[model samples]
Target: MDNYGGHIGQGRARDSQARRDAVTVEIGYALCSALFLAVVVFGVVAGPALAFELSDTVQGTLVASGATLGAVLFTVRVVSVLNRFAREGDSTDGDQPSQPGRTNPDS
Candidate 1:
């Protein structure tokens, strides 16, 4: 029927759009990650040089701020990777008990 053909066409179009959107998201993520790395590298190489030109109090504050930022970023990345791994594991191992100590009631 014409309606069935139209529905199929719509589904294919949706699938194509979803793929394009996913690729765009991946590219954006890569760009942002590269930018973050560049910023961190620049901070590591230039932070001390810039701080030396400032007063002791200002230098200390800048160092503290940089350290805090680095720690927070590192923590965020670690948590994100862990969460992703957890989700992937769940998807690949359907219905299995996720926790090691938890036994399946039917077993």
Candidate 2:
């Protein structure tokens, strides 16, 4: 009887681990999607704008502004993806305790 109980407890703990893995996978997908969008937008919108604005701004300012915008957008995109992955992983890991080892002392 004790062995059976331990087996069941271990199974529950395994389930919790599987849930954590699933959350990590989901976060990876989300990060990929976000990066894809960033690439598309940067190519279609920012690329063209920067190209056209080349002649409008003073030569130095045009280069500076373009460089600044590019850096800012890239930073935002990278930080957002990293933050999402970290936050999701943390939340999922924190939310589940292995059912196997946990017990109420009062009980």
Candidate 3:
């Protein structure tokens, strides 16, 4: 059931294994993308150190800054992606039972 869009799932239950799989795949994508982003950012920031003949302190500082920035970007990417996924999967899409732990009396 694609309630992520108020009617997207089409009869799929919210707790189905397929839904779980989708969540898993989304998480994997977030992780991989974040890692790729972090590495690229780190390389862009720290690459100078690897290519230049700067003093030890400057090289160290650049490396540190690169690592820090990369980590920050990685966190941001993962969080933003997961948050988007969560917002899209909200039970407020109306797929959830009107009341839990009870049968619908009108059924």
Candidate No. with top TM-score = 3
In model 1, which runs have C-alpha deviations exceeding 4 angstroms?
Answer: 1-52, 94-107
TM-score of each: 0.44, 0.45, 0.72
lDDT of 3 by residue, 1-107 (tens): 23245565544554477678988999999999999999999999999998999999999999999999999999999999999999978845544555688763224
Clashes of each: 0, 0, 4
Q: Which ten residues in a row have the lowest lDDT in candidate 1?
A: 1-10
Identify the candidate with maximal lDDT. 3
Model 2 over residues 36-87: C-alpha lDDT tens digits?
A: 7556655554465556755555655645555666556666766777677678
Question: Better model by lDDT, 1 or 3?
Answer: 3
TM-score ranking of the models: 3, 2, 1
Global local distance difference test of model 2: 0.61
Candidate 3 segments exceeding 4 Å error:
1-15, 91-107
Q: Give residue 11's lDDT in candidate 2 (0 to 100).
A: 56
- lDDT string, candidate 1, 1-107, tens digits: 23445644675576568757865665566456645864695488449857578787877777777767766665566556556645664475434566889975336
